[model samples]
Target: MAKTVIVYFSGYGHTRRIAELAAQAAAADLVEISAEGEVSEAGWSQLDAAQAIIFGTPTYMASPPWQFKKFADATSKKWFTRAWQDKVFGGFTNSASLNGDKQVTLISLQTLASQHGGIWVSLGLAPANTKAATRADVNNLGGSVGALVQSPADASSDEIPPGDLETVKLYAARVADVAKRLHG
Candidate 1:
C-alpha cells in the first residue's frame, strides 16, 4: 500500500476535525503535533515509510501555529538525509476569518516542502467563486496551495461548513491518488 501520514497541530479542534476527515478519506494514519513536542518513535518511522505527507494547521496571525513550526524545524535531520525528497507533500489549513490570509500559510508550507525536495500538491478542486456556488459546493476553487477551510469564529466543530469538508476530502483523495501512481 502507498502509505500516507497526516501531521497537524490544531488549536481549537477545527483544524483537527478537518485533518481527521482528510485522513479518513485517504485511509492514512494521523499524527498530532503537540506543543509538548511529543511524537512517538513509531510515528516517526511511519512518516519515514510513507509515500505522502499531509500537513494541517490552523492559521495563526496569518501564518501557521508556532507548534507546527517547531515540528517543521525538527525535520532538519530528515531533510539533510533527503528522506522526504520526491515524496508527495500536501497541506491544509482552517481559519476563523473568511479570508484569513490562508495563502500565506500555504506559501510557508510549500517553501518548507521545497527545502526537503518534496513534490507539493495543490487542492485540485476549482474555486467556489461563481454565483452558482453555495454552501453545498464541492470544489474549493481558487484556494491556496492545498485545502482551505473557512470556519466562522463562533461555529462549533459539528457546525463546520460542508463545502470545506468536501474540499478536504477531494484534496486528500488527490494526494492519495498521486502517491499511489508515483510510488506504485
Candidate 2:
C-alpha cells in the first residue's frame, strides 16, 4: 500500500482534532506545522517520502492561516525538484461560520497541490442538504472540492459537527485508496 501523510496547522485545536481523525481513519502519518509556521525536518522528510499528502487547516478570513501559507511557500524546494510529482493530494478546511467562504481555502489548497504536480482528490460524497438533514449526516456542508467542517464560534474543538468528522475520515480513506491504486 502507498504511504499517506497528513500535514496540518491548527490554530485553536479544532483543525488538529480533524487531522487526528483523518490520520487514524487512513492509517496515515500526522505532521503538525507549529504556530510559528515551521515544520520539523523529520516532518518534511515524511512528506517527501509519502505517496499521498493531505493538508488540513482552519479557514481564516476566507483563506488558510499564514502558517499554512508559510509551509506552502517552504515547499518551493520540493516543487522545483519535482519531488512531489504525481503524488496524490487532498485537503480539508474548518471555520466558525456555516458559510465561511471555505471554498476559497479549498481552492488555495488545490492550487498548491497542482503547483506541486500532485493529483487532487475531491470529497466524493453527496451533500446531505435535504430538509431533514442535521449535523449527524455526512456531507452536511455540501462540499465537493474537499472536506468542509464548521465549528460554532463558542464551541470547543470537540464540538465540531459529527458529520464533518465523519466526512474527514471518509475523505482520508478515499485519498489513501487512490494513492494505493496509483502508486502501489
lDDT winner? 2
lDDT of 2 by residue, 56-89 (tens): 9999999999999999999999999999999999
* lDDT at position 146, candidate 2: 95
- Residue 60's lDDT in candidate 2: 96
Q: Model 1 scores what on Cα lDDT?
A: 0.87
Tens digit of per-residue lDDT, candidate 1, span 1-184: 6888999998888988999999999998999887665567877888899999998999989999888998899899899999999999999988988779988998999889899999998887768788878866765436857988888899997788898898998899899889999997
Which residue runs of candidate 1 sit more than 4 Å off their true CA positions? none
TM-scores vs. true structure, each candidate: 0.95, 0.99
Query: Relative to the unseen true structure, what is the C-alpha lDDT of residue 8 in candidate 1, on a scale of 0 to 100?
Result: 91
lDDT (CA) per prediction? 0.87, 0.97
Residue 21, candidate 1: C-alpha displacement in angstroms: 0.6
Candidate 1 RMSD to the real structure: 1.3
Best candidate (score: TM-score): 2
Q: What lDDT score is found at residue 115 in candidate 1?
A: 96
